[model samples]
Target: MSSFCPNCPDQTIVDPPQTVYENYYHPQHVQVIHPVEIIRQHHCVPVYHHCVTYTVKDKMCTVSGLKKKSRKRK
Candidate 1:
């Protein structure tokens, strides 16, 4: 895939993984799918202190689709 990360396995991390991961949020075992974008807040770049954002829903993460959803006994 075009977005596959060179560092990680194929069809794993999203193509063009987040670049600001290491530079900004230093998280262990960081996986990225989509590239980081400069979001404009109030006509300026939003301030991201030190943390990465990846929405979790439907037992899958938006960025990295590899993350499994919560396993609950039926």
Candidate 2:
């Protein structure tokens, strides 16, 4: 007579998880100070300027659950 097992199954193969990368841009405000010459005053004066800058950001995530779960009753 042959025996059958519910908990134990045949050979199973599992794949490795995949890694995902996402890129985004971030904006930053910067202040610039410079000296300028005036025709009326005939002198140099300090000037303030506002500038916008962008930065690169990287985000990583893992993808899993390639195979479904098995529902077995004991």
Candidate 3:
């Protein structure tokens, strides 16, 4: 039902059998998220290890979900 690809802002939407009801996405824009370890480097020295979660959109170099932070009053 979308006119454009969810993963690609400039690309038009494509109706793939797997995504009939969902927003369309280009074949190149569809990808599987993979897990990996991230190492923080400080001038060639490893400072720390960073863990992260990847979504399908992220794996395809597209924007994923949106998160909002609540502020506390002093």
Candidate 4:
């Protein structure tokens, strides 16, 4: 049995440590599972807005439930 290192969990060393979770971290140890890109566009549906910014994945929604696939039959 052995304990993992806080700085190098995987026992890997990276130069010029990258910032992870707002802290300095090794590139090899830290991974960006979900990357969100900012996109600005005008939206009128649902609501009207001049400049609307949205994430690339749009995974920041607060509502919880299964996403609808298609409109229901009348």
lDDT for each of the candidates?
0.72, 0.84, 0.72, 0.74
Q: Write the per-residue lDDT of candidate 4 for residues 27-70, one digit (tens) a residue.
A: 57666699899999987777566897886754566567877789
RMSD for each model, in Å, please?
49.1, 54.0, 46.9, 40.6
- List residue ranges in candidate 1 displaced over 4 A: 1-48, 59-74
Which pairs clash in model 1? 3-15, 4-15, 14-33
Q: Write the per-residue lDDT of candidate 3 for residues 1-74, one digit (tens) a residue.
A: 76985575565776756634667766666678999999987686668989998866434454569566689999
Compared with the true structure, model 3 gives a TM-score of 0.14
| Candidate 3 local Cα displacement, residue 57, angstroms | 70
Model 1, 1-74: lDDT tens digits are 48875586556555775556445656699677997899776766789789788987677537765776798999
Candidate 4 yields a Cα-based lDDT of: 0.74
Off by over 4 Å in 4: 1-28, 43-74
Better of 1 and 4 by TM-score: 4
The residue-by-residue lDDT of candidate 2 on 1-74, one tens digit each, is 66975687689888898889898989899888998987775777989898999999999955785766799999
C-alpha lDDT (0 to 100) for residue 11 of candidate 4? 61
Per-model TM-score on C-alpha atoms: 0.12, 0.23, 0.14, 0.14
